[model samples]
Target: MVDQQTPVGANAPTRSGGAPALRERLTRRKPVEKLVAETQGAEGAGLRRHMGFWQLAMIGIGATLGTGIFVVLGEAVPVAGPAVVLAFVLAGVTALFSALAYAEMAGMIPASGSAYSYSYATMGEFMAWVCGWCLMLTYGVSVAAVGVGWGQYINELLHLTTGLSMPAAMLAGPLEGGLINVPAAIVVLLSMFALLVGVRESSRVNAVMVAIKIAILVMFVAIAVTAVQDGNFAPFMPMGMAGVSAAGATLFFSYIGFDSASTASEEAKNPQRDLPRAIMFSMILVTALYCLVAFTAVGALNWADFADGETSLAGILTAVTGTTVWAVIFAAGAVLALASVVLVVLYSQTRILYAMSRDGLIPKAFSTLDAKGTPRANTIITSVLIALLAALIPLGPLADATAIGTLFAFALVNVAVLVLRRSRPDLKRAFRMPGAPVTPVLGVLSCAYLMFSMALSVWVAFLAWLAVGLVIYFSYSMRRSALEHEDTVEVRS
Candidate 1:
């Protein structure tokens, strides 16, 4: 556990006497000791710490393993050919580099804001706000993306089990000629209800769903391997390295939830020790599962057949088994899998907003807790907004935005680790990332490379979102920040 009584700003740099007020405010750093002390003081008034190591690991796995293997392979395999397997490896490698950085920071800080809190302690308030803003995009949009994918699998399962499909008008958004994706919105609400009950309850539900999804994937590998064709390996690199890189960028969406455990730091019984272990363990396990499934998936069917994003792993199962039984089973698992993603990611989003709200960077309503120690208002408001997005937006755009936002946040995390190591070397860390400066530098470079591989349209969309965030920050957040008041008090005293 962190030493909660360390004085605020004990190791923080003294402000330069000649610095301008505006510059000082913009670059003001929140000491890690202060963060930990606040958390300790909140005790019963804040989120309850009920999660153990396995639950945290399950959060990571449940959040990560869903959308990629079940939904994204269709989008990625056509781009990378049979070498989509390599794309999974590439994306996993990128996530691994950042995961190491996240583990180190989680051990030292153990806060709910994840990278955003780390940024506050190291990069100052302005950057922390930016990182938290990006995280809002990452987790909020990702829930919608995963929810949309869940609706597709629900459609597949309905078709396989009952020989009937949902009305197309109700199954997709306007872009797909539907009025609204009702099932997608419905799943988001279901996950919200799970979270409203409490984090402990949500974690239990996620653990069960995570187990089911993993078993389903393992079943897929077993059934698909029997149907493997050496011929599928022949034209593996048909699209070449460019295709591979592009697919890696797309597939990076699959690894988005691997760091979700870090967001649960405040709710973990032993965050410093368990949080780091959960992060590293979950990433390694998720990467292995991704590589295995991707290899088997490409081997089982021709890569060109994956163009239909809605019918992904289930289609493969149906084709291989020559029956709807296994495909139906897989589709059912997929529904549960994607629901778990929505649940965990929604939890992460609420926590990030809670941290920001506590800092007065957003409305205090976001930080309000119910009798169960759940952020009830925050959960409902976030879920309603995200559900609207899921109901109205197309999955493709939602996913691309999520990928870009997640990569940007992750890059900041790597930078945070470097900044903190140099600024506060005396802080105890239960875990340390090896090859320090070199490793984090590579993490940043890899995230940038993947971001660049995305289409220009994605970049445009990301910038537009950031522009909106900047406007909010300047107009409201900066003036209302709790740090501003704290600074004033110190000067007066």
Candidate 2:
């Protein structure tokens, strides 16, 4: 067995007892600060940073408007009734606070791995590893879950419009007592290929899907508002404030995908200048759009009849139009929108893993970039794991688990903003969060409140995941940490 211990001052040549294991103490900055510098300087090895505030907004809409709205209606509407509209506003406000905090961090750190990199720079190694690990749960597997959802809606659309007779087992997810969901698996593979091709290419396709999605929602609202019945909202707070808060927890998931935009800081045209703008702008746009859709949706249908699963929006349109045409079109738009989200989110997860591997925190294999500068090895492995999980489990658990991992990251980032402000006040910030203490405090409290409202089972699952992370960190990460050296240190003073 190899001994991992280092003598005191192991990295300092000036130390008495041991020759400097000079590389160890210096480990602190390279994986943390150096990577930070690398992203700002040289990370655009493949794709050019050409996105603007508008493109960033579209990316936000593309990611957030998909899965939760399409799938969550069945879950949230029943719980809060017409008050689900208020729930959307409540969740939007909570997420907006966190997003503002994130924008501030992105301006300062401007790294490729979003919250993980920020944690490393401010909180040090242990928390960074945990954040990165939880991030995998948040993003890596979410793509698989959304892909399965897209498959269901697509199959239904085909049946409703094309009159194709598809078998239940072929179309149904594995969790639904089916052997395999061929369409879901197929979509995952297709998305993997697109991601492998390149981000620029993916973004082009993403842009088109985003436009369609926005159009579909606008069309839904325009028609729905015309059909509003005041009767539907007589008992607006049917389930009361508690129900709104509870549903707000899940609806918060719809607001989260904006963070992925910040992860592209490495590929941003001007990170310190534009990354913060992009992130905040995206958050604001999505929040307004969600509020609009929620208000219109509750007014278009009786709150009691919204538990129609994937058909909630469609059903409302059908009831109002006295035809299925608009509903089917809306569902089809949803499928395309969700598909883009799954692909982009999966790409974000793999890239984050690749970043960690490059720091030697994980196996070096994970960081290997193909000729195209895509992290093929990491992407494939993560996809396979996500596919298996999605095949066997339902979306509720997967979504809640993702929320837990994400909120944990959010709390760390909120705290990190404070750490960096105090520790590196001299660092130039292109963007700033006003009322520093209040912003971060509210951010943490809001995230924590939502996290608690989730099912107890989610809490247990999160604990189990944390246990696994600790085991890995103690067993291998501590020993291999680039910062393990006892001697060398970088100091500003």
Candidate 3:
């Protein structure tokens, strides 16, 4: 029932005639109007639209709330001191602009691929490939980073529950003085299994994990409240505005998964209405939670105490209560919570690749879904590669790459919003970014600022990756793209 005209093979009427045809196709953007039609008309299509507002919001919350606070706090707090509280607010505001752009686009497109699909529809095949490549790096590297974080928590939980721990050699990748992160790889494989079973099943599991994680954080706030000291918050902005901005740049990782709701647009029961609500609600909820935790943690202990990346939050609880019980509970919650993060991040990765595949930008095998409407082959392939990275790579470098890649994609979504508004003013939008061009313009500027704050080494690595993507685009994707052929035919006729 997916408007047969918009099916995967619909655009493959015939190959473009020659070089002119190919060039035209490559540069020709899929009209936003047509793509919107395909999505609106494809209801009884393959993918099930079973997700409601609550389920969709949980997907965003479950993915966004995990590693950022539990792990990255250690790294960010020391940079900004107690002003890290303002850092969270700054990062959330920056993320809010992009999130508004995403909401508007989601209402109009209502498809997978998040920014990539929006770009393909409004920008062109070439730009679409670029967005897809950025997304692949963002989600792919994020999975590895989350997995490694989970490994640290696993070690903490093990040492707490039983008086035994994995040897340091078995606990981290070689870059971190360990043989391999075996626990990280194990968790990725487990998430892969859950996804393969079904989306609804995975959704349920993600919701439950989110509930438990919120409960754990709530417990921390309650206990940490009793121990709050006025002196701890004195001299809050010790590092000044520059440090606050830098910490905000780093803490941007915590806000990455708020767009998970947008990715599920294709699976929403009433995407136009529910998708926007889900995205907006999730963003507000997450921003509030992040601020509360930041304020409470800093109030309960000196910012200097959070310098250790692995055990900062748990250590704070232990120091405050004079008991190991709270720390143990926190560690156990981290272990479970980061697992759900893996599941959702990996899920986003596969779905983006699947959308690109369906568009003929990648191999169809990557997009081919089973009877249950899950991308089984795609999930397995992504899991294998991610597991290897988690097992072999260091967390610091992987985290840097993910953040930069995501910022690049966020900038483009804002651009897409600007483009679509001009090209399709009549397009019905369930939600619109307030202040129009100003909001998206600010989104682009803010994302670029954060990207500039990244280490020079990260910029070098991101450029090298983009260089490789161009080669793939020119050599392979150029000739095989149906968008090219479809556009060429329209122009010729």
Better of 1 and 3 by TM-score: 1
Could you tell me the lDDT of residue 336 within candidate 3? 87
Ranking of predictions according to lDDT: 1, 3, 2
Best-fitting candidate, measured by TM-score?
1
Q: Give a tens-digit lDDT track for model 3, residues 1-493.
A: 1112222223533344433444445545666566556555554455678999999899888879888888888889888999999999988988999999999998888887789988887666788899999999988888898998898888877877797988988778888877889988999999999999999999999999999898999888899888888899878888898888888888888888888887787778888888888888989988988898888999998887766654468878889999889999998888889999999989889988888887777898887778887888999999999999999998778878888888899999999998878766888888999998999999999999888887889899999999999999988887677664453322212
* TM-scores for every candidate against the unseen true structure: 0.95, 0.90, 0.93
Candidate 1, which ten residues in sequence have the lowest lDDT sum? 1-10
Clashing pairs in 1: none
Q: What local lDDT does model 3 show for residue 55?
A: 91
For model 3, the local distance difference test gives: 0.83
Pick by lDDT: 1 or 2, better one: 1
Q: Residue by residue across 311-373, what tens digits does model 1's lDDT show?
A: 488988899989989998889988988999999999999999999999999999999998888
lDDT of each candidate versus the true structure: 0.88, 0.74, 0.83
Residue 179 in candidate 1, Cα distance off native in Å: 0.3
Q: Model 3 residue 468 lDDT?
A: 98
User: Runs in model 3 with CA error above 4 Å?
Assistant: 1-17, 21-23, 37-45, 487-493
Ranking by TM-score: 1, 3, 2
* Prediction 3 TM-score vs. true: 0.93
